[model samples]
Target: MDRPLGPVPAHAALEALLPPTALLVPEPAPPWTAGWDERDENDGFRPDWLQVRRLVRELMPTPKSVTRERMAEAEKECGALGLDGLDGGEGDFATLWTTRTGAWLAEEIFEGLTRLCDVMDLEPRLRDFAEEYVRRGMTVEAARAFMLAQ
Candidate 1:
């Protein structure tokens, strides 16, 4: 089959690689409305970022050549985006729910996720899920509900 030529939607890309049951315990969808709230005021960093990384490894249908250690290393390198002090406009909050500390669902994270789909030959699946995800407006709340309802 021919491969998709460009980046896939982030959440769909992630869902395609994770186990079907990953949503059994869905992370609390961060409230994007709370734009630029301080991390200390809101709480600590959001776990959804790292949580996705963990799920990708834990829920693989088959263990590919990639090792857990390698995944960890990937996390170390791309994991923490000093999400503290992102001085972007409120409109930026539309896609990312960031804290005053600056941590958020950045594009780089999604890029990494979609790249994983390409490596795993899951781009077709990602495409399907991406369509659904887009239909739901690409909101985390909708993604959680859709995954759970499945």
Candidate 2:
């Protein structure tokens, strides 16, 4: 992993500006699209509106960004798959957009997310995170969390 070093001052400056971008890759894809697995079901189920709102808010980090649209699509897929007992009432696209999120969940929206990530260039942040975790304001767990977030 080691490479040649630049002068100390330039190295420091480069580190401050950005970490190496090659290492940060999105997490592995998720499994499950639809269909109930009875073994995974629970007896009681209740929706938590507070958690729902918070979770939705978290998804819509950029006030008026495409994430909102993407979320709606993912939700639709989640509903369909979940109602059908696919996830036993719990499902998320997570990193599945790499596949389905709910693959067929929201076809257009899933495609849009790919475009959005391309337009946003998330790989750069990913790369820096891989290069050096501490410099970018993340704990070891937080670094793992970032991968999970993707």
Candidate 3:
């Protein structure tokens, strides 16, 4: 009765905060064994980076992400056509996609994706999704299939 209150272990506190099914899942192997290294650089930048981004986002359920992605793509395409004449031009999109700079930007953005982000940069939802995957007994192999099936 005289024992003073004790601090909970950090892990215990985290576990308490998580859903009963929460888990710690490992990252899936990048789908393409070699990665998207051989992007077609001649034509207007293909925006292949968007493909990588899509891959990562779909792996996790961030909700509302689909709409945002659609919107971003629409905006970029619109800009490329210079329909708005404010942000993008066909040439602008072409330059961004077909050059080293564009690839670099795509690589950077792919890493910035919440699911694919560096551990230190992950948002709470992305981190939670990783944990939940483990909790749900998703193995790296299963994750690969899961991603492919989607």
lDDT scores for all predictions? 0.36, 0.34, 0.34
Residue 96, candidate 2: alpha-carbon lDDT: 25
Which whole-number lDDT from 0 to 100 does residue 114 have in model 1? Answer: 48
Cα lDDT of model 3 by residue, 121-147, tens digit: 333443343344445443334333323
**Tens digit of per-residue lDDT, candidate 2, span 91-145:** 4443322222211222222233334443443445443433354343223333444
Candidate 3 local distance difference test against the native: 0.34
Candidate 2 regions with alpha-carbon error over 4 angstroms: 1-66, 83-150
Clash counts per candidate, in order, are: 6, 5, 4
TM-score of each: 0.24, 0.20, 0.18
Which runs of model 1 end up more than 4 angstroms from their true locations?
1-15, 22-24, 28-39, 42-67, 72-139, 142-150
Can you rank all candidates by lDDT, best first? Answer: 1, 2, 3
Q: Taking the tens digit of each residue's C-alpha lDDT, what string does model 1 give over 1-150?
A: 123333445544345333333232223344443334335345764444444434433533222434555444433443364322112223322122211111113223333444454355443554455344434333334333333333
Instruction: Indicate whether candidate 1 or candidate 2 has the larger lDDT.
Output: 1
Which residue runs of candidate 3 sit more than 4 Å off their true CA positions? 1-30, 38-61, 72-150
Residues forming the 10-long window of minimal summed lDDT in candidate 2: 98-107
Best by lDDT: 1
Q: Which ten residues in a row have the lowest lDDT in candidate 1?
A: 94-103
